[model samples]
Target: MNVSSPLNNEFAISRRRKAAMIVQMMISDGGNLSLSQLPESLQELLTDELGAIRLVDRDTVLGVAEEFIAELGSLGLSAPGSRDGAIAALSDHLSPTVAARLREQMESVRFGDHWHIVIDLPNSRIVDIMNAESVEICAVALSKLPTSKAAAVLAQTPGERARRITYAMSLTADISPDAVHRIGQSLAKEYGRPVSSAFDKAPAQRLGAILNSAVTQTREEVLGGLGEDDPEFANDLRKAIFTFKDIPARVKPTDIPNCIRTVDPAQLSSAIASALAADEPVISAAEFILSNVSQRMAGQIREEAEELGTIKKADAEAAMSSVTSAIRDLVESGTITLRDPEADTDE
Candidate 1:
């Protein structure tokens, strides 16, 4: 009538048992380890091992730590653990076609079960699968997908399919890995879209981002030329480009406080002074920012900027660009929302 403890076991100390001990120790010590980055199978084993053992002797904890440290010291090199990672690291050395082929071959490797790939498919495609495939397969698919996306797909699915799929999910606890793997492979073959990770973003967005960093004169020249040759692309690129002048149009007034907080006081002053320095300056941008911030802060910044007097246009522009970059970061982080440009705005 004794419950076995993985950590307390003095004999047959497996690597997994030791790992669970270390992971538990780290968690107890408030370490924010990204255990999610580990392969799902490994995570499951770690979770199981951790669950089996309630407490560890200090000696076992110290032994595990010492062993882990020694093992780390002994490693001269570590290769990329997954084929995708390996392919990316070796891409410069490998032919593009070869690298792509290797990426496709990833299905037979760590993703051999193919559930990861299946779950990454578009939500609409998943809904279509639910419509066409058996209720059991749809249930298995939902179980494989991340909870939020699964919920969305289930909500979008027809009433009958959704009800059946939910019932099937309850019965999925005992499904065999081999059967799940087979289902995943079949689903992927039938429905998985070939995604090219060649570029993390669209071409227009990449080009626009490059222009964001370019000197204003150079950016304007390029945009002017592009406008003539490829009006459609140029129009799209213009939407992506958010410059100092675009602030008044694109950024929300309410976000100004949070946005400017990211900039240094001197940098903000310089940008303001320089913008106002021009013969026909960007008054709207300066006013937009000043109006949004507190009156005291606005007066202080204006006074400092005026005192600096005649900052080099280039220096001022650089500071302004820094402010714009901070704003972009806030937008990207979902901390602030930008007002839509003319293209998106209601008349």
Candidate 2:
């Protein structure tokens, strides 16, 4: 297979340099080379080419290549057979003053590097780190973040866990910069870059979405707890958690059709029928669903509902639940966007 253009030049240069180094190493060491002593990448490449060649012959060649690559890396050099190595070679060739200037410029792009570190850390690992620390410490660290990043972290956490952390924050007063700085230093070490004060915020709808997927009991308990502690904040969480009933008010006319398209036709019909048949019918929801579809399709759905005559409340609820789940999935995947009334009207 042909290597991609981006890999070709660097791979060739690195491979040549490694091969030369391996030869020198082997000659110096009594012309002996061991395949097992070679780096795995070089070994794999050489092994692939050894299909027709004798194993012993190919092993010696690979052994040398691995030693060369390792030696180059040890000398603060990039592996000659990789893209990074090529970049390192170019940097090394530049004048010292020019290189120092470039390094300074690169350091200013720390945000990108910091982002990669955060992104590379798995959600579970982040949670583990938070859980391991004292609640006060965790809260202090979280509060130091800008709202968006804090929200993103909270969204990933289980509702109950997030509530505990939020509660801890409420109970605490001032957060010491020294404490935050120490934590920052540890995290910076892991990231291999200086810690910088920058973070990306998740959208409110996305946070709502994470809670939507949470267990109903956990969501309720957490919200109830938050309500007891801070009623207004709890109310905000309530507004964020959208349900099927919110479809009429939150979903835009343009997105309604696309949202319905994602739901099963049978489920949509059942959900609409059940809503219409209720003692206090969800007229708005029924209208929202019907208005979004073509007249012919709406008529057919109505006919189907009429033929069903009566649906048990349980069945209706189950059907509606399915349709709601489909809508949530669509929204989360960005197939559709739902407007948040409160967020839009907020000053």
Candidate 3:
């Protein structure tokens, strides 16, 4: 990566370049690493020298270098500059306060070569959309940006403005999947085919390209079949799938309690037992937990969870909700941990 960017203030480029140089030097040593391995004091001393050369605090420099090495290890290869740009781009996308601090410590920031502008103004006419307004009005008003400031700005516009842009986008010929596929086929036929390696990877966006396929059941069946075999493997495949436009209202309170009664008490007890083992002790861990929560609630959940072995439909859903919420709060507050490692393994 070129640490010297056209827009960076002075000293940033130099600092980043030094960091890169230090990383290069470390990798050049040709040493291997393992989980059990520990660096000697000599190696720690070497880090100080490298840190000075990189213009970073010793610990900061070593920590970053270690992370870099781990990443390289994952890929089982290294390519200088390929990762450099990504680092810089991520820095470029940080909030102003964070970016300023980072800029003070380094020379260059990374930025993407291109970006997209999605708009969704509902009432705006298809033909009346303006790109400048989309950029200025919508993009300029958002908070907590995850990417470049400019890109974040475009994401925060009012819903009406977004709808207008989306409406305009809808008028385009891109609506016809048939038209686009034919063109892709034509290009592929002409160019032959791309040579791909085992390392060939698809980005989330590329994986989302299946949204245009026309057959609803066909898509579901294909994806569902894969999910039946390995659910995690197909998780990303449904990233952009469409669903019903209307959402139903919530179930009644009585219905919720009935749902709670459906949980298996044995499963629930095992889960809670595990959670309690890892959990920090309150003045009286079990007592305190049961005190704030109703005994009847706990009883119902316990009964339902226990019935898992004998019956499939126990209707302990309401009780389960109470248990889940209580457990979540305790765990989040650091009051408890799952003592039973096997509890989560059951599901």
Could you tell me every candidate's TM-score relative to the true structure? 0.46, 0.40, 0.18
lDDT of 1 by residue, 163-184 (tens): 9889998989999998988899
Taking the tens digit of each residue's C-alpha lDDT, what string does model 2 give over 17-39? 44544455565688866664455
Model 3: ten consecutive residues of lowest lDDT = 243-252
Please identify model 3 stretches exceeding 4 Å from their true place. Answer: 1-97, 100-315, 339-347
lDDT scores for all predictions?
0.83, 0.63, 0.39
User: What is the clash count for each candidate, in the order shown?
Assistant: 0, 3, 47
Cα lDDT of model 3 by residue, 242-332, tens digit? 2211000111122323322433555445433433332243113323333434678667545543444332222222322334444434434
Candidate 2 residue spans exceeding 4 A from truth: 1-226, 279-281, 345-347
Backbone-clash count (model 1): 0
Q: What TM-score would candidate 1 get against the native? A: 0.46
